[model samples]
Target: MSRRGWTLFLAMSLIWGLPYLLIKVAVADLAPVVVVFGRCAVGAALLLPWTVATGQLRPALRRWRPLLAFTVLEMTGPWLLLAYAEQSLSSSLTGLLVAAVPFVAALAARLTGDEDRLTRVRVAGMLLGLAGIVALLGLDIEGAQLLPLAAVALTVVGYATAPLVISHRLPDVSGVAASSIALFVTAVVYAPFALPRLDRLDDASGTAVLSVVVLGLVCTALALALFFALIREVGPQRALVITFLNPAVAVLLGVALLDEPFTLGLAIGLPVILLGCLLATWRSRPRGAMPVPAIDAAA
Candidate 1:
């Protein structure tokens, strides 16, 4: 990678990696709905004007069906579920759990015929990924953790499905417009749930408030812009290195800052999950054979 590519790469990795920590903080006081609503509202507010000014919003909005589906799949359900899961699950575990997306995406791609076949390496990756999840559950899943674990599992499916929606149904849309509109729609949909809690912020700490602001402006809006540019610069395959890095960053931040537990399961499972993700998503062929570009959870 060139100097500029490295800059975008590292920036995006950090930007995307920080969200789990921020969500954990914000949801400590705010409702999960409030956190999602705040993030979508702030991100949409910051990006809408620019998308409109650049004449990208209207063209992208024309395909309303896929756009709405993408919004719900990518932002609405996953965002809320993730935030709610964080209420019971630790931030580090939440981030590590999301690493399951690639495994699920690989299965979705193969089943949908997005790719010709799942390579032997991908099959192995999938098995390893499953083992990691099993280990995680076996180690940490007593008591109330099961519910949050199920929520996280749904989130993984949503994250995987959103990219397919974009690749198959909304491939021609502008990235900026798609992200902005999806966020706007999410904010609007969650308005009723979020609005009633607006007056409850009096007891919330400054850290909780600032975390949501950062989640909205930095993690959502700025990170998506950076992601689009990174994809353009490095291609989607290379850009996905951030995905491999983000879970590690999330775990590190959680341990270092929040003093979250780094259990044996985290120690044993994180690397295995990342290895699975790498293999499952790896391309053995020449660069030219890569499929159509698509967004990921980074969006």
Candidate 2:
């Protein structure tokens, strides 16, 4: 990785990581739909114009079907579920649960015939990661936390599935355009639910309002743009290292700023999950095959 890659990696780690905390704060006052709507609206407002200026908007809109699937899978469902989950789960836990994405992506790739080989190391890693998930879940998988836990699992599936749609179905579409349209779709879908709750903001604290604004402008718009660039620069597989880093940042912020718990389960499970992610996503060299320099991991 170049200096730029490293810079983007760190920046994205924070950019993606902080959203957990922001969602936690935003949902303190705004409803889940409002948070999701505000995020997509702000993202669309910023990126749609960029997509047009870049002359990618037309091409992006032409692939409406796949793009819509991508949007619903990537942003609409996951973002709403994430916001809703944060209402009960700690920011740290939410971030860590999402760390399972690479494993899910790995499985999705294999299942979709995107990758032919699922090596022993990767399978082992998946098992290890699942053990970590079980460890984490054992701490809070009962009663009130059950629904949020399920929501996080589904959110992981959505996150894992969206990139596959891009790689398999919409590879030619501009990242900016795809993102812009996706935000537009999300905002439109959530408008009815959000509008009715708009009046509730009148009673929201300054912190809550600021959190939602940051969620939109920084987390949604800027983060996605940077994420696409990171994928371009480092390749999608390596770009995912951001996933390992984010939980750490989220945990720190959750503990320091929000005073959320640093639970025993997290301490035991997080490193295990990161290790599993590293192993599962690792590319092995075949002795007879020609050397292929590492590029982006296949989407």
Candidate 3:
């Protein structure tokens, strides 16, 4: 990667890594629905105008079926679940759990016919990633609530599946436009639930409010723009490597700023999960075979 690519890559790692911490902060005062709504609305507010200015809005809207599907799978479901789960789970652990996404994405891609057969290395990667998750749950958390853990698991699956929706179904759509529309729809869908809770914001702390704002403006909108640029600079496969780094940043932030524990499970599981992700996503091409197009893996 060039200097510019490295810059974007690092920017994305920091930016995307931030949401776990931000969500943990925001949900301290706001309802999970409100946090999700605020971020989506803020992100949509910025990206929608750019989509229209670029004349990509109509093209994206024309594919509303897939756009809506992408929204539910990516933003609507995962964002809320993450926020809710953070109420019980530490941001560090939550971030590490989501690191399983690549392992799930490997299977999702094969099931969706978006990739070649899963090699033995990829299968081993999946098992290793699963072991890491078990270690985190067993060692880091004491008698973890089933519901929150289930929510995180579902969030992982949703995150993994959303990219396949983009790669397979909405391949031609402008990524910015699709993301803008998805964020808009998510805001709209959650408006009823969130609007009713607007009164609650009056009692919310400045930190909580700022966290939501940052999540929307910086994490969601700006991060998406930079991620697209990163893809253009380094290509999607290289850009996807940011996924491995994000949880590390998340863990560091949680530990330093929030004083979350740097537990035995985290110390052990983080590197193991990351190694599994690296091997799981490794691609090899046969002679004369067409190169597999990389899927969008930005979280």
**Highest TM-score among the candidates is held by which one?**
3
For each candidate, give its TM-score against the true structure.
0.80, 0.81, 0.81
lDDT of 3 by residue, 120-159 (tens): 7756766675666555445376767999999999998887
Model 3 misplaced regions, further than 4 Å: 1-9, 116-138, 227-241, 254-283, 291-299
In candidate 3, clashing pairs total 0
Note the Cα lDDT for every prediction shown: 0.76, 0.77, 0.77
- Local error of candidate 3 at residue 71 (angstroms): 0.6
> For candidate 1, lDDT tens digit of each residue in 16-93?
889888998899999999999999999999989878998887798899999999888889999999998999887756
Q: What's model 3's overall lDDT?
A: 0.77
Model 2 over residues 89-132: C-alpha lDDT tens digits?
97756776787787777677777775435688867876676566
Question: Candidate 1 lDDT (Cα, whole model)?
Answer: 0.76
**Model 2 segments beyond 4 Å from truth?**
1-7, 116-118, 121-138, 232-241, 255-281, 286-299
C-alpha RMSD of each candidate structure in angstroms: 4.3, 4.2, 3.9
Per the 3 Å backbone cut-off, how many clashing residue pairs does candidate 1 have?
0
